[model samples]
Target: MSTYLTILGYNSAIPTVNASPTAQFLDMEERAFLIDCGEGTQVQLRKAKVRFSKINHIFISHLHGDHCFGLPGLIASFRLLGRDTALNVYGPKGIKEMMETIFRLTETHKGFEVIYHELKSKSSEKIYEDSRIEVFTIPLDHRIYCNGYLFREKPKERHLNMKEISKYPEIQTCDYHHIKSGRDFELSDGYVLKNSILTTDPTDPISYAFCSDTRYWEEVIPLIENVDVLYHESTFLHDLKEMADHTGHTTALEAARIARKANVGKLILGHFSNRYSDLSVFTDEAREVFPNTFLPKALEAVKIG
Candidate 1:
């Protein structure tokens, strides 16, 4: 299966006329995840033509207004649409209290349950996993409690080798499942046919990492090493790196350096500062360090692998 990422919004600090704050929609391994619900996130998701029902989980990087202000509105919308399934929300420790307070104050009644998964860990840890995908947290260095998520597809079973299996008459169609599961085939005479000789390896698993609103952090290299696609925040140019770090943000050049060190297949620089009229400057600066660096196109769905 392939992974698709849609940049719902990629601006920093606040919403601009052309862009909104940090938000993204990730569709990986048949699972849909909404990452960071900034202002105007629901509108952006609608603009991108994404089905609201597809998203069962929402991940907020931090409690920053620009990163999670739209969450209440989105959850309310889900209720209005007659959603009956439970929603899982993962975020910093205060997220559950923050959201429940908003709902309570607004007298917003929900027809479904909203499960909260609050995180306060400083070290990296696994948060969600299924048969096909596994998600882990990438502890980030931000002003507040924050985390980046890594989505990795699980390894698939080997493909059946019809040519090799046809050589043996005793190997019936029922045995194909066992062979594909990497089990050896044995004959009545005690001769064995190795699984490696009968089947080919499956496709390599794909992975995507979303690192938002963090300073220049090198400790995340091992956690996200060699990912298929990486979306890291680049809120400033190199000239404003001091300010960027001071505000718990990363420069475009620094993001590229992280991508290079981690050996990622591609780097997507986003969460840009509105101060720069020309967005191309980010790509120009990052490409100097990592040639595969690219800028995020808001509302566009990009295939990660």
Candidate 2:
């Protein structure tokens, strides 16, 4: 199954006329997972034509206002739409307390059940897993208890070669499943044949990492090494080097440097600061370090194979 990455908002801490704050959506198979919930995220999702119902899981990197300010509104809208499916939210520590306080004061009870998974440790943590995908937490260097997400697709079973299958027309359909599972097929004539002889090469799994609003920390590079797509925050230009360091943010050059060092396939730069009216500088800075860098447009959907 193919995975689609949609950039809902690409702005930094401050919002701009043409950009919003940090938010991204990953569509795998038929399910949708959100990376962040910046302001107007639901509207952005609707504008992008992504079905809100498909999104049952929400992940917040930190408690920053720009990253999670839109969560309550999104959850409230889910109730308005009469949704009954359970929703799971994974975020840093104090997320549950914060949500409980906000919903208690506002008296907003969601129609569906809300499950909160608080992340307290700074390491690779397994947050969510299902038959199709697994989500891991990459501890990030930020002002608060922040973390990134790595989505890895589960390894699929081997597929049978259609030509080989057609040649063995007398084989039963049940035997086809076994052959596809890389099991030897023993014919009625007692002729044992190896499954590998009839199968094509195994397909490699694809993985993507969503890292944002963090300082340039090489410690986490190994966790995200060789990812198919690495979406890292590039909130400022190199000229603001001191400011980026003080605020625990990364410049475009720094983001590209990490992508290059990690040997990732594609580097997607986003979370642009409002100070820069033109984004060409960010792309130019990153491309100098990593040639396969892409500046994603707001609400643009990028496919990762």
Best by lDDT: 1
lDDT scores in order: 0.93, 0.88
| lDDT, residue 81, model 2 | 91
| Residue-by-residue lDDT tens digits, candidate 2, 1-305 | 67889898989888777888989999886678999999999989899998888888999999999999999999999999999999999998898898888889999988789999989987798888998789999999988889999999878778778777677766777777777777887777888777877777667778999997898899879999999999999888999989998999999999999999999999999888887888999989999989999888887778887
lDDT of 2: 0.88
Best by TM-score: 1
| Residue pairs in collision within model 1 | none
Worst 10 residues of 1 by lDDT: 159-168
Candidate 2: pairs in clash: none
Residue 164 of model 2, lDDT score: 77
Q: How many clashes show up per model?
A: 0, 0
Candidate 1, RMSD to the unseen true structure: 1.0
Tell me the spans in candidate 1 whose CA falls farther than 4 Å from its real position.
none
Q: What is the TM-score of each candidate against the true structure?
A: 0.98, 0.96
